[model samples]
Target: MRTAKDRLRHTILFELLGLVTVTPLAALILNKDMGRIGALAVAISLLAMATNYVFNLAFDHALVRMGRPVNVRPPWMRALHAVLFEATLMLITLPIVAWWLNMSLWQALATDVGFALFYLAYAYVYNWAYDRVFPMPSAVRIKAADR
Candidate 1:
């Protein structure tokens, strides 16, 4: 398990890095001004930050309940997590994306799917790196050892 402070740090770093990388790419790909894309990026990032914090907390708790080490998510679990995260995020962002870019729902869905795909890959890699860089305390293992 990680402390609240650690989770907060993780969320902040993830969002900041994502924004830096995604904003320019989104603008270029969409043929929009950087400011417009940047604003949208920031908005989506804010929503994601909140979701990331809550989702990860719940995910760790699920691992604990399942007798799995909180620090080590299996590949299957990681994939599921990334997929679910992106799916939910895309749903939330689709309307906002359409409004911001003045696109129809179908266009927004297409654009959102692209964003989701990028994030699906990004989330997997980012989490792998994050876990390596800031390993979580293995509460489950430690508890089992005491038994």
Candidate 2:
């Protein structure tokens, strides 16, 4: 398991990197002013940051409870993790996106789906890289024991 401080760092880095990459792309793709898209992105990012922190901590704890190694996830588990995270986030963001963009529920669902797809992919890759770069302490112990 990771410390609270480590999880905070992870959430911050993930949000910052995501905002930097996604904001411009969203603005360009939506043909909206950057300010509007940027504001929406920032709002969503704040919500996501909170969700990311809580969700990841809970997820790691759940894994430990189930006798699974947090950092030694298989691809299927990784996919499930990303899907679950995005699904939760989508439920929370749908109405917000609809209000912000002045779109119908269906339109917002479509837009939210687009964002979810991006995050689904992003979360998977980011987690894979994050785990490799900063293996959990338990993972480190397990790896050392194997040697």
> Whose lDDT is greatest here?
1
TM-score of 2: 0.91
Which digits, one per residue and each the tens of the lDDT, describe model 2 over residues 109-132? 998898789988998999889888
Task: Write one digit per residue (lDDT tens) for candidate 1, span 1-147.
Answer: 888999999899999999999999999999999999999999999999998899888887777777677777888889999998888888888999999999999999999999888988899999899999999775645456433
Badly placed stretches (over 4 Å) of model 2 are 139-147
lDDT at 96, model 1: 95
Candidate 1 TM-score to native: 0.91
Global lDDT of each candidate: 0.88, 0.87
